[model samples]
Target: MKNARLATATVLTAVLATGVMADAGAQPTSLMDGVYTAEQAATGKALFEQNCSTCHNADYYKTVLQTWRGQPLMYLFEQVMSAMPADKPGALMDTEYEDVFAYVLQIVGFPAGETRLQYAGGSMEDIAIQPAP
Candidate 1:
């Protein structure tokens, strides 16, 4: 039984070590890092105006942005993408959802870049939002 326990422990250690190495090697996309291009932010703005402005106004960010400033855009993206328009959750397309995130980033004063912000394959904790450049 001692041998069995030792084998199990060794296997567990290998799995844990692999997981750590994978996480360390991975590079997460940041929401504040020019992920979305200016065009995308503009497009996202229009979508937000049409779909979200009714309930949430400019002041909403004054409170929420502070807490979310350094977080990944995807974090904010997922929450809004999953449940927004309060009246019509999950109503927007994935592209539209990403666009909306761009708009929110713009509103929070993050600078617009040349690339569009992707909705998946990134974490929010990796980015830091800064005032527009």
Candidate 2:
């Protein structure tokens, strides 16, 4: 009985150690995965028309994206989210930012997938925006 208890304890310890390691080595998110819905992009388009078309157009935004490639998607998202509308900053909802992101993705011809783009609990340090293929 004592030997059985020792073995059980050893197994439990191994399992716990593996759990810790797995959590520490969690996988990073990728923007290639469809992170935003097409409908969401449409919403973004409407919002853009109402909020952003006066100052910039899709073509100009595309150039900005090109300039910011190889960077974290979150950085660009945050930068635009915080500084957009020229007069208003941080006035939009998280979902609004996400919708605009989807619109940008669609404008750039990235195939819209079923999944909403990676949101990563508001931190996208792990997800890199790859250059368009």
Candidate 3:
């Protein structure tokens, strides 16, 4: 009976350890994945038109894409999210920022997939943004 109890305890411990490991390795939920619906992107486009179109256009990032340096999407998003509009930097809400991001993505011709591009924390040097197909 003691041996059977010991085996059961060992099995339970192994199972618990496995579960912990799996959770640790799990990927964080991306911001782009279903965070904004198609309608939200349209709203964001309109907002940009009313608020930011004077200073910047949809092709603002075309040069960046051609250069291919710095954080492709996330880098641009962070900069805009942190300090943009020139007139009112750091004023837009998070959801507004996300909407603008979606609009920018749309302009860039990156077809909106089911996954919204989440900002992955890391060095931008290694991250490669492939040209839109």
| Clash count, one per candidate | 4, 4, 3
lDDT against the true structure, each candidate? 0.68, 0.71, 0.58
Instruction: Please report how far candidate 3 places residue 80 from its true position, in Å.
Output: 1.1
User: Higher-TM-score candidate among 1 and 3?
Assistant: 1
Q: Give the TM-score of candidate 1.
A: 0.66
What candidate 3 gets wrong by more than 4 Å, as runs, is: 1-37, 68-72, 117-133
Candidate 1 residue lDDT tens string, 1-133:
9999999987886676446436545454444567677888888888998999988876676566655444444556678777798899999998898888778767866777887677555533344443333
Worst 10 residues of 3 by lDDT: 123-132
Candidate 2 lDDT over 1-133, as tens digits, reads 9999999987886676445435545444556666678888998898877777788876776787667554567778888778886888777787887887788778876777787654557545555565554
Q: List, residue by residue over 1-133, the lDDT tens digit for candidate 3.
A: 9999999987886676445435445432232333335666786798788668898775666665655332234555677777788888877876677777667657766556554334444322123344332
TM-score of each: 0.66, 0.68, 0.57
For model 3, what is the alpha-carbon lDDT of residue 94?
Answer: 67
From the highest lDDT down, the ranking of the candidates is 2, 1, 3
1 or 3, greater by lDDT? 1
Between candidates 1 and 2, the lDDT winner: 2
**Stretches of candidate 2 above 4 Å error?**
1-31, 118-123
What is the full ranking by TM-score, best candidate first?
2, 1, 3
